[model samples]
Target chain A: MSVSRFIAAAILATALILPHADAGEVAFSERRSGSTFMAPETQAMQSNDTANPGMLGVLDGATLWGKTIGAAEKSCASCHNDASTSMSGVAARYPAFDDTLKRPVDLEQRVNLCRVDHQRAPPLAYESRELLALTALIGRQSRGLPIAGGTDPRLTPFVDKGRATFMRRQGQLNLACTNCHDDNWYKRLAGSAITQAHPTGYPLYRLEWQGLGSLQRRLRNCMVGMRAQPYDADAPEMVELELYLMSRARGMPIETPAVRP
Target chain B: MLAVAAMLGLSRAALADALRPYAIVDDAIPLSLTGADGDPARGRAVVLLRQNTCLLCHSGPFPEQRFQGDLAPNLQGTGSRWSGGQLRLRMVDASRLNPATIMPSYYRIDGLQRVAEPLRGRPILSAEQIEDVVAYLATLRDQPGKHE
Candidate 1:
């Protein structure tokens, strides 16, 4: 017999004996942070503040916080007065309900809203270095704290919408966010480990991107990978998804300015 | 697991025409996709190809591979478990069997949304490639701990 035929025969006789699991939700006690899936060196990079490149954005943000900008000539420091004291644990509970908008707004959106309402400044562009720096600074204050988002009773509907989005199959690939992140966490996709979709790290540095980015950016990237139409940057669905992710990661410790491969 | 160049006597030029329509009979597609038997050797190569994204979600008897996904069932003994026709329908589109399946419909084009610009209007696999993979899967019939 030809080598291919022999191998084929061997494979056929031994199929379907492997065990498989039905799709379901991951339990809270079993939840894992994304860092657990990274290489030791990469994890070390995130653990060491000096070695972490995201800290550079935090330093820049510190400078911007005090330097007055915008028509109001007021800076983030003018009103908030020391992010360390006031903003501590703020990021951990974001994607919070907004009474004015009748919807939830993520940390980034809140920053933009502050700029619009108080600073009299035009909202910074998404993924802009300044926005990333500020968010990185704010997110860092919440590092080591447990995520507490999606707790607002008013946010129930938005959170539900976000969960639906995560579970729904979309795009040409016909996959849902839950398909890989939920069912295949700890599995390898090509060469990379598939981590659970948690929002523990935000304004985090990704080695592939070589810069800090928001959770929305990551969500859009996944949609593109699914061969699906990504939501617009300002879409409410983006905040909704972020809200749901924060809730899903309810008790996981925050790892702002995190480094990921 | 050496990669084999496809030699199914077919070409991209041969697939330029519209997708060949096939009727599903109950749970199977009982006709050759390219009107010819596919080469099992070439089909095996397609399964191992990284771009196909199969190994990302499945494990098989390929000992040389260091990382294999555990998302889906193991690919061993597929031939014994499923008929060639059923496997063909699956290769073309598994969602017909289970709507919530994470598997991509390799030979489907319509109803898919927001395909990347470069891949728009094209199925994930060609007719020949699908046939080749089906042929290769059908050869995976050796039972575990009871190899023939």
Candidate 2:
């Protein structure tokens, strides 16, 4: 028996003994044992009572709100009023097919278009904090709305394309998003557990980035992890992908600028 | 107590005794190195120090600390699933095994650098540190269930 074989046998035995081991149970046990891998001092800070600032971008967005731009003399307030009310549920139906453009358009593109045509403001750079802040503000209006997208017929092909992109295996791991997020979500990967890949709350503030970012940015990051060439921000493929993701999270309430670990 | 100890000894002996009979080490190291002999206490220190920043991508048993990353998988029970060697390989160079892994290799023996090295030719964690982490990981096993 080789050292590897011995280890394999031991693991097999452990697995057999713990046949019913679930990630949640494992995490729970680690917590209770007081033998947790994490430091005790840090544990107190992570307790449920800790209040995370929910949406930081909203603060930046409020400042930009109603700011005038464009040659035609228009501001965001020209069309949308008191964003908390009039803009409500607007983001839930985005990444729709633009009949004129003959492609999918996300909220970001729409905002840029509004800047280009309505406000005459220069289109904000992709992945810029300004764009993310604007998107966060816009998405906040749709907070609590169910994600409702892809009802139009023209969006069908794009949705399917996005779905294919998500399911296709890429990179050195030869893994699709479905592998971990869809199939092995309950399974362990190192010390952490996987969660369902829900996009309901996006344009979120991630603990990883310690800043606000859009769902498209998150998706591109995942693509980079997948070793796949990511589509440019607000690109047709990315918009289509967002549409697919939004459709998948149809009923989940939008947690705009969500906090994620 | 003696019987239980004897049983544990027998089990260890049986595992140790079986080595070399069915042992096989291919050019590509197998992914079965669980850090059975690793020391968790040492790993904890390594995590806190500049070596391996497992905390950078995960929120784990340590929440009091800030700057822990939330993107990658957590490292609570990493020892239970991965062998010491596997963990070492992952820490040294995750891209070699999983091309898409966002993890940076602590050791660059094979000259793989996903990002520029903060310390050239120095692993984030030493071999002994890897063992310590494996020890810490082993402690994560056997806990009561809790809500994630």
Candidate 3:
């Protein structure tokens, strides 16, 4: 056999095994997230907790954890008690199925539900400072743990919905999520490197925004870039897409309160 | 990247000028496009457009442009390699050649999913717009000393 043919066979074998491997492991570990592709100065910000502006969100979230709010006058601490213990690893397992909701709900949505139902307080508005802070605090607890959840049979339907949305072309630009993060994640756009669309470091502080925002905010930004009208903050489509993203990011470590450019 | 983005935004105002109807189909690499004369100046505008998003996936040799994408081939010397007809087909639709190409069809609009309401049946670029881009790209023959 020719050397080229032997190399081709090896490549073909690996491609065949990729799907089964992705089933339980991290999606595209071979392809690094956008974080690894950024300039050194930007990466440095994500590394040092103090230098990371998203840390501000974390600090503010800590205050919200203790302060009483809503008509119930209850705080996140009242029931969950010391987040480090109760919420530990919880963020990693999000986009989990909620029996009451009967559909998948992301960590942000879950928080809002708790605020309205358990705490008797109004749900924080999407991308609101309070919402980002609280989400970041919870996410901080799961730092370094692989993103998890979506294994249950109940989640399969929503995962399919999310996958369809990801693959489907949208907006005036006629671009899909796969067009960038999947097909061209390693390629450069202008001078910026495209990272595989992992949801690892969300509720992250972006240099462009100069503020912290939830993953949904980032999704909305992408939608607008496609010239598509974005779904509302609490839309079901967002939840489904989040579920699909979480499943794909199954084993990537959480990097909440992350910084980005 | 930001500087490149600004330049693209400013130059794109030239893309939607006057365009006549034209159909693009698959046959050869540089498909024949004799219906209307190609316009390099207008073509340059389409490729540099931010809203049109050509720069988002491909790069080319344009003196005024600062940054270019590297996802696909560089368009610097395409004219020396393929004919205008072939370029027209690519502009019309790339999937005909490689069923799995990531390149978006600049002129094909059928069977698309999730297009904006006002642009449901419209091609990404009009026929005359495609001709302009083809004309511009054809002028980019391989020049030894042209690139730095």
Off by over 4 Å in 2: A1-54, B1-148
Native-to-model Cα distance after best TM-score fit, residue A136 in candidate 3, in Å: 0.8
TM-score of chain A of each: 0.92, 0.78, 0.88
Number of backbone clashes in candidate 3 = 10
User: Which structure among the candidates has the greatest lDDT?
Assistant: 1
Q: A106, model 2: CA deviation in Å? A: 1.0
Q: What is the DockQ of the complex in model 1?
A: 0.26
In order, the Cα lDDT scores of the candidates are: 0.83, 0.61, 0.77
Give me the runs in candidate 1 sitting further than 4 Å from their true place: A1-23, B1-17, B60-68, B74-83, B110-121, B139-148
For every candidate, give the share of true A-B contacts it also has. 0.48, 0.00, 0.52
lDDT of 1 by residue, B45-73 (tens): 88888778788788887878777777667
Q: Put down candidate 2 lDDT per residue, A25-85, tens digits, no spaces.
A: 1232221111122245433332322343435577678667688777978778778878888
Better by lDDT, candidate 3 or 1 = 1
Better of 1 and 2 by TM-score: 1
Model 3 is docked with a DockQ of 0.34
Model 3, residue pairs in steric clash:
B29-B86, B30-B85, B30-B86, B30-B87, B31-B85, B31-B86, B32-B85, B40-B136, B43-B132, B43-B133
lDDT of 3 by residue, A35-112 (tens): 887889988989899889999889999999999998999999999999889988898888889999799888888999
